[model samples]
Target: MSLDDRQLLRYSRHILLDEVGIEGQERLCASHALILGAGGLGSPAALYLASAGVGRITLIDDDTVDLTNLQRQIAHTEARVGQRKVESARAAMLQINPEIRIDTLAQRADATRLRELVATADVALDCSDNFATRHALNRACVAHGVPLVSGAALRFAGQVSVFDTRPDAQGERGPCYACLFPEEAPAEEVNCATMGVLAPLVGLVGSLQAVEALKILSQAGNTLRGRLLLIDALDAEFQTVTLQRNPACPVCGHLTAA
Candidate 1:
């Protein structure tokens, strides 16, 4: 695909980068991303991807905008309090880049729907607040061989990682999300409603998710594959942990290989 005059100007900065030249920008323009949740993390991630010229973005969320969302959900305005979160987010994304096509699914990300959505997406981002949905998304992405970029933030802490079951250039398969956190493992259910996340904390992590998603789509830079990046807003420090796939992982067992 060739970049038209308008597209070249729209992505001028990206095209000028040594890491993301014209070819890379074209890849981004032809990519499709599915974002789960239109809340804190999804808000910024969706906006950035739209602005970056991702051809299609599908956002899934059942929630509505509330006054409390103003702190971290940069995509929604105070006036949109009663509107569906996806509606508010879509408006903001279109305002940023009218050239991009966006689809909004105002529903929860259940296992069945998640599987269908992941099957058609090039990459999926898990910005959902609950562990159940996150687990569902991970399983779906792994099954479909779609790259998954997962991020979470609560209180003052956040984490980001990528799971791509697809083999790398050297024929090495990266660890899937379930490989790091087994399905049977107990995970805390953290939410902004109860835990109270810092306003900018979500943006900090979500924007990073956007960057990782773009890199994965364009195949330009080294992503956080099989590694977890932890962010401590209170301490303002960042840490990385290497992740290994469990040989006995049920999700990646011979019966369910991606």
Candidate 2:
């Protein structure tokens, strides 16, 4: 799949990078990305991925835009308040890159539906706002052997990481999301509404998620597969820590390395 003249011009900046030259750009232009949310984090993630020329994107969300969401969810406009979130996000993404395909599903995806969706996605982004959905996505990604880029933001704090259990050249794989935060041991669940998130924090984290997803799809740079990136908006600091896969991880432990 070669880039046409227009695509070359559109992705000239990415092609200039040695990491993402012509070959890498083509990979990105052929990849399929599944985004599981259309809220604060999903807004920027969808925007960037569409701008970056990911060929196909499937956005799943059951929520509707509200006046209060304008503070952080950039994909929704005030005029779209009563519209479904997936429709709003699709409109926002198409505005940037109409060449790409954006599939919108305005329904809450269950576990079975997640497995079906994950089966076809090259990579999945966890922008969902709850523990249950996050855990379910992790399980589905693990079962399907798809890479999952997870991001979360609340208040002045945020975190982003890649959970890819696929084996590397050395047959070693990174930890799944369950390895870091197990479902059985649930953390104190929080969201922007209850915790009052910093508006820009989610944008930063979601953009980071887009970066990781692009890397994985393009096979360009080393992804944050085994690293957890922690961001502190109050102090304006960023940190990355190595993550070790838990052998007893409930979601990914049973399967042998691929």
TM-scores for the candidates: 0.97, 0.98
Candidate 1 wrong stretches, greater than 4 Å: 255-258
Tens-digit per-residue lDDT, 1-258, candidate 2: 999999999999999999999999999999999999999999999999999999999999999999999999999999999999999999999999999999988998988899999999999999999988988899999999999999999899999999999999888888999899988894887777887999999999999999999999999879889999999999999999999999998788886765
Error of 2 at 38 (Å): 0.6
* Per-residue C-alpha lDDT of model 1 across residues 1-258, encoded as one tens digit per residue: 899999999899999998999999999999899999899999999999999999999999999999988988999999999999999999999999988889999988689989998898999999998878888998898788899999989899999999887877776677877788777888777687987989899999999999999999888889999899999999999999998867677776543333
Please list the residue runs of candidate 2 whose C-alpha ends up more than 4 Å from where it truly belongs after superposition. none
lDDT of 2 at 116: 94
Q: Name the candidate that leads on TM-score.
A: 2
Question: Distance from true position, residue 92, model 2, in Å?
Answer: 1.1
Output the worst ten-in-a-row residue range by lDDT, candidate 1.
249-258
